[model samples]
Target chain A: MITATPRKDLLLMGIFTLAVLTMPIWLAPIGASYPDLLQRFAIFGIFAIGFNILFGLTGYLSFGHAAFLGVGSYTAVWSFKLLSMSVVPAVIFGVITSGLFAVVIGYISLRRSGIYFSILTLAFAQMSYNLAYSVLTPITNGETGLQLSLNDPRALDSLVGVTPTSGIPPTNFFGIEMSGYSGFYFCAILMIIGFYISMRIFRSPFGMMLRAVKSNSNRMSYTGLNMRPYTLTAFVISGMYAGLAGSLMAVTDPLAGAERMQWTASGEVVLMTILGGVGTLIGPVIGAGVIKYFENIFSAINENVLHGIFDFLPEILQDGAVAVLSLFVGEGWHLTLGMLFMLIVVFLPGGMVEGFTRIYSRIRNKNNKNNGEAGSVGSAEVQPGE
Target chain B: MGILEVRDVNKSFGGLKALNKVELDVEEGSVHAIIGPNGAGKSTFLNCLVGLLIPDSGSVNFNGNSLLGIKPHEINQAGVSRVFQTPEIFSDLSLLDNVVIPTLASRDGAFKLNGWKRADQDSEIIVRAEHMLEDVGLIDKRNMHAGSLSRGDKRRLELAMCLVQNPKLLLLDEPTAGMSRADTNNTIDLLKRIGERGITKVIIEHDMHVVFSLADKVSVMAQGTVIAEGSPEGIKGDPRVQEAYLGGAHL
Candidate 1:
């Protein structure tokens, strides 16, 4: 029921674009401005945004989306090997291949719903992972993973008479190399475009139908609507988003690994979506940034860094504090992530967006009370489902 | 010939018979009421007609086409809309969205890829949805979540959802299942107000007041089959119908 005006969406888009584009400037204080981490933020943000279309809108929890990500990475690497070092062909092939893969898996997996549907997807992903790791070694390159070789036919590069160097060429957009700051910017632009498309979907009739499917599928059928195609379209779209993210991963660092398709990777995106807030347009992206920040920042903290921060304290007390905190950082960062995930799930079921809305409404209410306004109580309340 | 015809429809669940040789003929532009005591196959018959339950042996013809073996949405696309007894609506959506969905379903058929356009920007559908909300006297709450409405209001919203479809036939299962006397009367008045649309309606109800006020014809069912059919007055006084209600101990 929260009506989204064009003005409101435009305003939201403006803020989102500014925030994403200025990551290097603002996130410097938090030490997350490095191009690799920034690129991860944009790429995973796209993944989570797409994942929300199916999981948040349709309420279908897929535990196997990593398969699409894996598929996209492999397809992109293959495109780079056979076609060109330019990322355009790789990204296109990645999205298209994963979309077709989604059509097949979604058609089969969607025959079931709820836990069964999740299990079916998980099974599919695990199967794909195993195949990519061992059975499909010729294409996936098995445990060593897929990477470009110096001798491989770079069709487009050769056709353009672009001589190969001794080292494998880095991926590029036309002639602009995808590395460091340039790579981060490219991924950021694509992420913004993906976010815009997601915003349009959330405001579309098709999106309403997806929500209807989530709200009451029985009533939807009786009201003369089919639930399958709507959900399938959402699933395929989401898979394509994962594919896009995967292709970006390859673009940034021309290597496709089997680990990218692992179940844990799929679970990571789920955690990001839930941690940010499901169904909200910007929540998943925020979640993606938070998780990536934790993975990069928290894991970087070592005993020496802790000792340096606690150097002012007495020797014994400093050692005890460092020892106690060591389990929460470094290799133990997953424990911290797990704790945060549990907290978000238990207390903030609506995620960070709901928390922000609650804080915002409380501030508005206080302002209204100070102004002695009796009306406008409902005006500040925004539904998180939007 | 009636607009809807059900002949010798039989549905059984294992050892229990839910419907047995059920025959119903709903004339065009008529309000046909089926009244029965608990577990009298009223809801089952309605489900059979709408393809929710496939009758084991029977033919359900709507507008001269067989309703057997078709999907529920397909049946709905063929102009058959159903309202559940418990007021099944899109509770997470706004009241306006609750109405708008059905209109979109009717306009676009079962599935459409209209993602390029904004749903709220479609002035035609938005205007029609607002009009429906106004008709149900809930235009002020159009922005409120459907889940937040009171019980009586949810029922009204459900009716608006069905009515917006402009279906050829409307099947209602206990349109007034739980309500105060005042709310029940309001529903009766609302049904009468919409009677001008002349949409054929098959309503299964236990409320006799609702039956007498709206039904052009009444069918009384007992056990798993219809025992008597006539005008509401004729069916009310029929000894066989009375026996079915009270086991012949009185009346």
Candidate 2:
């Protein structure tokens, strides 16, 4: 019902591209312009966008999506170790491997619905995490996780004579080093592409089918529509998005860790999607940015940093303020996050996007009243004509 | 054999036999009505036909093809569409979508990976769905949310959805369970229009006016067993059918 026409589609794409590309400049005011944090914004934004495809569109709340992220990271690291230093192959490997992983898990997990479906996915993720931690240690490298090794046989790199430039090889795009500002740009480009694909999915017929599955699956089945494959396709696509995000992380850092598949990481993406607006196109990415920003700021705020700001107050009051507030900052950032999430859930069930829409509509209504159109046209008011 | 045949169907829940030795033969292009009191197993019988329930020992055949132990979607793909007692249309979707879903399924088979095209932009589906809405006299309400429609309109919208599939056998469970007199007569008129399309229908209803008005044949049931089967006039005059309605007290 909220589908965009082609003209609106292009306009939305243009606005999205402008906003993402100008992040370095716009984010400077918030002290979020550093390359590492900026890259996390793009990477996790992608993760949240993909998660929304299945959870928001189809209402299948998967608690195990991080398994795909873990798989993607491992695949990317392996590609760098065994094939070449180019991120292209690593990203490709990440998407393909994660897709295959999703196909298996989704097939088994989608057999159930509602809480059972969520638990099944969670069980699969936990299994993958445990396997990566211990059982599949040889291939996964166990607790240390996968990392690029210099002595490994990189057949493609050897054929291409792409030896290490310095003491350690940095991932590159056709020999261009993926570091600092350039790395940010590369990830930004990927994030834009990811957002574009998600936007298309939101407007496509397949997207409608997914929504139908969410609306009333029994009716969908009785309507001669089999919704199983539609949900599975959504699951795999979202999984590939998580994989792509994971691959980007490895491309930037060249390290794969088992913790990426942890339930906390999966929960974080769910939080991002729900906090930003579960079913809205831009909500999840915004949620990702907000959560990442708070995590960074809250973690950086030490007692001394708090005291520095509170210095304007009297000495006794400053000490008291820092002491009391310290529980929600620094290592206790999650407490603040928890409180914020609770508030959002209680006050804005439709998430931050709905909050914004309500505010915008209120403003427009006030403006219309000021312009004397309230008396001439009462279109905003619902009439009981029937 | 009729288009839809149910033979020796028996279903039980624990100690209660919900449907006991039920048999039905819905003929081609005929409007057959099943009238029974509450707990008469009319709904259970319909569920068995649509693969929502499996009878302990029975056979359901549609066009000579067995409809047993198959998935719900498979039953739909077998050219059988059911209208729920309570409208089961997608509440969150628009009326156009509610009407067009069956069209999409018919054109695309049971399942498809058609993610590229926009559903609204597809002229073929829109045309067909609009035509169905027109048939149900609901062409103007196409854009409204299905859930927001009135109770009577919800039934009409669901009917349009089922009819859009051009199902070989249309099975309706309590098609008009609660309605005002005007809405009931309006539904009767719509069914009369549908009857002209020559599609076989098996409807379960309690309204005698509706049964006497539309059904070519009527079946009366009580305690999960059919007691009488005949023309509307004959069923209305049957002593056993009267006994079933009056709970074995002579009327």
DockQ of 1: 0.77
Candidate 1 chain B: minimum summed lDDT over ten consecutive residues — where? Answer: B242-251
Residue-wise C-alpha lDDT for candidate 1, range A1-386, written one tens digit per residue: 24589999999999999999999999999899999999999999999999999999999999999999999999999999998999999999999999999999999999999999999999999999999999899999999999999988989889999877668888999899999999999999999999999999999999999999999999999889999999999999999999999999999999999999999999999999999999889899999999999999999999999999999999999999999999999999999999998998999998888788777777777888889998465864345366
lDDT of 1 at A170: 86
Candidate fnat values, all: 0.79, 0.63
Which candidate leads in TM-score?
1
Q: lDDT tens digits, residues B129-167, model 1? A: 999899989999888889988999999999999899888
Candidate 2 overall lDDT versus native: 0.88
Error of 2 at B49 (Å): 0.4
Off by over 4 Å in 2: A1-3, A374-386, B248-251
